[model samples]
Target: MPLWLLLMLWRGSVAQVLSYKLKLQKSMTVQEGLCVHVPCEFSYPWLSFISAYVSWFQKGADVNQDPPVATNKPNQKLHERTQGRFFIRGDPQTGNCSLDITEVHMGDSGTYFFHLGTYSYLDTMFSLNVTALTHTPHIIIPGTLESGHPRNLTCSVPWACERSTPPIFSWTSAALTSLGPRTHLSSVLTLTPRPQDHGTNLTCQVYFPAAGVMVERTVQLNVTYAPQNTAIRIFQGSRTALGTLQNTSSVFILEGQALQLLCVTDSNPPAELSWFRGSPTWKATPICRSPILDVSQAGAVEEGDLICQAQNLLGSQHISLHLSVVYPLQLLSPSCSWEGEGLRCNCSSRAQRAPTLRWRLGEELLEGNHSNASWTVTSSLVGPWANSSLSLSGPLGSGLRLSCEAQNAQGKQSAAVLLLPDKPEPRTSGVIEAVAGAGTMALLSLCLCLIFRVKTGRKKTVQPVQSMDMSPAGSSGSGAYQHQSWTDIPAAPPAPAEARPISEEEQELHYALLRFPKPKYQEQEDIHTEYSEIKTHK
Candidate 1:
């Protein structure tokens, strides 16, 4: 071991120590009252005997000023010499010289330097940029949000520069998300606005680096929408659906074909309303304006459903109504036809709505069993119609007037039929019944006499059709069979016709007033007609 060899090694070691490099971060970013880390690393000769200490110095705004801020010396706690805000996070023994700055303030914005010291010290400086955003976060909602439409809201945080670190943002609603980087640090909130969401509160929370303090801001959402209910009324017709319901439902009318319909609505922000046909295309070209709509315009078909729409900037609502244009019950003339022992009367007509039909004999409602009354609702290619019928037996009295009334919600109509040839005269006493019967019998006897007189010359011998009781005065008239259910008499049937020998002289017999011939027994049918038409004296 020569002294010269040791001196050479010593000089080499000194040169290696002098060549060691201290790496320092060029700049750091900080927010008011927040914490920041200064990056530092260094390389020195290994196994060296010099112990090293780490220190930090904050430079002034001026070019030539520097002041010590914090240090890590052996056996020294950070709180003994400096405030709790500043500390050393790295160990010089491990060549880590990183510094920590907590509770940073605006005045802490300056150039900073780091030093590694043993017997002497080696120092280098870096830039510190501090931004103060001590206020609350701001929320922005542009314009008005329309219900049922997609829209966006913004949570914005102001920064000192475009290059400044962006603040972390959180929203009370999970719908918040991030969009890359912009001039302002922001989080976007996307939503589809709804009418029920009006006046809802939305909050945006932001965590800033300056002081590590979180700020919250809230903004209310404004949503616009149209009417939710509508109703209609018709003049000269019943109110639709009974009251002011959203559905106009149905309206019935009679008489005139023309109609007036009024529409009423409830809405927010005052809706723009109009009348239309059944489809959405009708809205583009409305049939009319305002609340009133005229359905009967000349040849227009107003029988189908119509729509009323109320609209605003937000949305539109519609109400549906059926316009049933109906006319009064139209009863056609009823005709009576004889069917066996009974008579049938058939009445029919057209009506707008459902109709009820009834038959009345003067004041009493009349109905027959099988030959009875009937009513029906029938549908055609055009629309619906009703038909009805009534029947009566031969026992029905003569001069009975039958009336058929057809009625509906619109109105009523009627038709009548007369069962007799002429208007009947009333009878007062029971004796009048016998007198009237006698008069009828005498009139019929006169007709028979005229018929026999005409035939007397045709036949010389009496081809005795049958012999009648040459009885006199007034007793009774009987034949092989009596006609039953005749209208002239209430109970007695017409006498069966007979033919007998008649001398021409008997036709000339004249009396004050001829009495009714008495009914007499007959052995068999007459040789002449079985049935004969009766002729009455007017």
Candidate 2:
């Protein structure tokens, strides 16, 4: 018992106190069905270090009254709570008294003590705690998570004991949540799920007080939703508009062309699509069953509507497309013929669609350009083709040119013809005109000769009447009343007179008289004369 020996003993005790970790992790969190390693190391005299002399103990919430539940020593049997779960495998020569636990179960969360038995037994100053994860966090979700609908998910972790500390819960989603602590701890997350949430995992983690790792669990949501915005589209045809068959735009199909329509939609599960023939109503006629609506022979008969319908277990939607056949104007026999003085033009064109046809004479396209011609006229369809006619009349010596143009949505084709009439040539026409003139002059000259001969005969008869009876109807007197119808004699008183002879210059030829137009005294003569005398003496 020297001073040096006393100092060495004091230093050894100090080393033991400085090197031993009296407290295991204040609390440890381990998962169920998993193994945990609790290591204990302390400074001890090299030769006296004994693994067989070590012992471990556990204390629950009521440490002062509750009996210990677990231990690793061999002198006493294992506690029922941790009987088959606890083991210590440190070598006998080593000072290590590390404990190995298998399939850690709940009810293991409590304070633990480590003791080393020597000449005098000593237990660690501070008690270590071993916590076994009561329950791994799990997620509970609803049957269906639809877009725009409110939803909630609960993450729960059971506590080992009523007095067990609350396990920290965390949610992967940044949603509003509420934490509840009871026999079990729960974190409820509230959110609205969208279609994008399909196949996404909602995760929850449970962390114990002293556990280095958190227990994580996930639930993959299988979101059930209706079909997205349904639209109609036409993948074929260069004439398609807005990727749809628009009522404003007539979808034209050529002869023998196929019309295909698609019902475009987006959904969780693929949507079932159908086709209808007309404007789809409550009582619409369904044509086929597919996203691709096929019109095998489009425009074979008449135009119709193609309604595309998309549906699922959720709902159905539709769109309509107008189908029509289109063709350019086809001109039939277009010709110009003579109709009396005017040249009549007739033309008929074949087309399935309506076409605007106009008539043009040379450069005149609007209507009539001259006073002699009439406006261009259009006629309704007589049969498969539209008939049009135009009458062009004018004083002309040459043929006129006319055209008929048929215009439609597809294109335009015009038919033209020259309007000519059968006529004599200009050179031959002059000869025929001269011959007609000569014949007319000869007939007039013959009539003039006949009139002259009749006048000569009439003058001879009038001369005899003038020489025989040149008497007045009422005469007072005359030098000699010879051959007078009525005459009177005048008395001469002792007077001798000589009369002069008439000169030839004073003579005049008698003019012919008309019997029908009588003189001015004809009205007076009618009273004195008989009806037979007033009549012509033909």
Candidate 3:
């Protein structure tokens, strides 16, 4: 009796173990803060009219004491650890048992089993490996970034579950940016790119509060921009930088100097720099294709305007440099001629800048069109040329130098003429001495006549002696009487000679006669004026 009963029980237990059959995915891998779905189906012996419920529980947990992680029953309670994150999605009436887990954490890593009513299947289960979050946020750049243009950028965590707590999104960038729309797992950012923002890093960070994990992605921005901050640098030589010019400017340079100019600008893509001769347009061919422009001394004569241009694919910019070449003052040889009792001199000069003309007469600086007692100076300036006329009318000094000088900011120049001594006139001096001796004889005759008149008065002689006074004779012919009276007056004392004996050294005095030859181009009559300087030896 015992053998038959035990054989029946053993067969029944084996049949019950084989009847609870299930099919499901064996193992699944899910990152923390993400979701996973385990597809499962099971066939169990049950009545058709009775309603059945499906449930899921963590491995090594008591189904009766510890609550199930998921349940489809109306009044069944769930595990606090996975109450909202774990659920059984399929209907039990259709023999479908799919386990869905959202916001899976590291603590949820283990084996799980499915239960249908009072029956449980442990052989057909799935293992969830909840690894550390390794997924990064995705940065979506719709198109090319252009400077000064605003565009929307999207940062999303598409792999994260929507049922999980919304993640906090943040953006970090050096560009001008503002907040845009936000969804369950993504955030939008409105970005305005600038030239300076090129090649800069933009980071998108997502923080999952439930999992206490954060993920981020960084991308470098490529911004297209136009040429900006166009400027020209002036270099005096190869090594020295004089200054920087950002706008149009006028500059002056010495005649024999060289200049070096460099153009610079800011842009995303490299800009092309060029140098133009004058006010040329963009279509004109440039004098220099590089950024550096070298101006040699030979080209200084053609000074006017120079332009520097910086162009890029986006836009272009330029600056102008006005040039003025200055030269030193120059003076031509002075021309001199003799006018009526005066010496006339004309001087002409030219220079880049208007030069001042003046006359230099023996250490005296004479300027302007003013007149004095001895000399008159008249000057005129037109453009770069200057002309001056000097007239001297007075006692002339021998061995004197007269010079014409011109001066300006660049330099000064002068031209001079030397006056030479001339021989004295001996004939003109001898007649002056003879006239002095005749005047002395006349004075002595008058004194002798006065003395004779006094003696005649003392004698009381009534007879009038021939009047010895040599005076102008009346209407009568008394030419011979006047001669006799003059001879008789000489009986008075002979006048002593006041003249000194002349020595060889004192015989001749030096005189200078300055005579200027008139130019053939002049139409005025030739002047005969001459200046003579005479001096006696001491």
The parts of candidate 1 lying over 4 Å away from their true place are 1-23, 31-35, 41-50, 60-68, 74-86, 102-107, 115-123, 132-212, 215-328, 366-385, 395-399, 418-538
Q: Tell me how candidate 1 scores on lDDT.
A: 0.59
- Model 1 per-residue lDDT tens digits across residues 228-337: 76677665344344344466577655445556677776555778878887765632787776888875541227777788888776567888887676755666666556
Give, for candidate 1, the lowest lDDT window spanning 10 residues. Answer: 483-492
Candidate 2: regions farther than 4 A off? 1-136, 159-165, 173-184, 233-250, 268-270, 300-302, 335-355, 367-373, 379-398, 408-410, 423-538
Worst 10 residues of 2 by lDDT: 529-538
Q: Write the per-residue lDDT of candidate 2 for residues 227-278, one digit (tens) a residue.
A: 7777777755653543654233457677567766777877777788778776
Between candidates 1 and 2, name the one with more favorable lDDT. 1
Colliding pairs, model 2: none
Candidate of highest TM-score: 3
Q: After superposition, how far is residue 523 of candidate 3 from its true place, in Å?
A: 25
Cα lDDT of all candidates, in order?
0.59, 0.55, 0.76
Residue-by-residue lDDT tens digits, candidate 3, 1-538: 7999999999998887776889898999999988898898888775355567778988988988889999988777888889888888887787889988888889999999988767779877889998999999999999889998999999999989888899999999999999999999899999999999999999999999988889999999999999888998888866599889898897777778888888999986889999898877747999999999888782445588889888888988888998777766767777766787777888888877778999888989999989999999999887668999999987576766688788888778777765544322111112332453355455543332231223322333222233333323342342222322222211223222332333545332222222333322322244332222211112
TM-scores of all candidate predictions against the true structure = 0.41, 0.49, 0.68
Off by over 4 Å in 3: 1-15, 47-51, 236-238, 250-258, 296-299, 324-357, 362-364, 368-396, 399-401, 404-416, 422-538
Best by lDDT: 3
Root-mean-square deviation per candidate = 16.2, 25.5, 17.6
As a whole number from 0 to 100, the lDDT of residue 426 in candidate 3 is 13
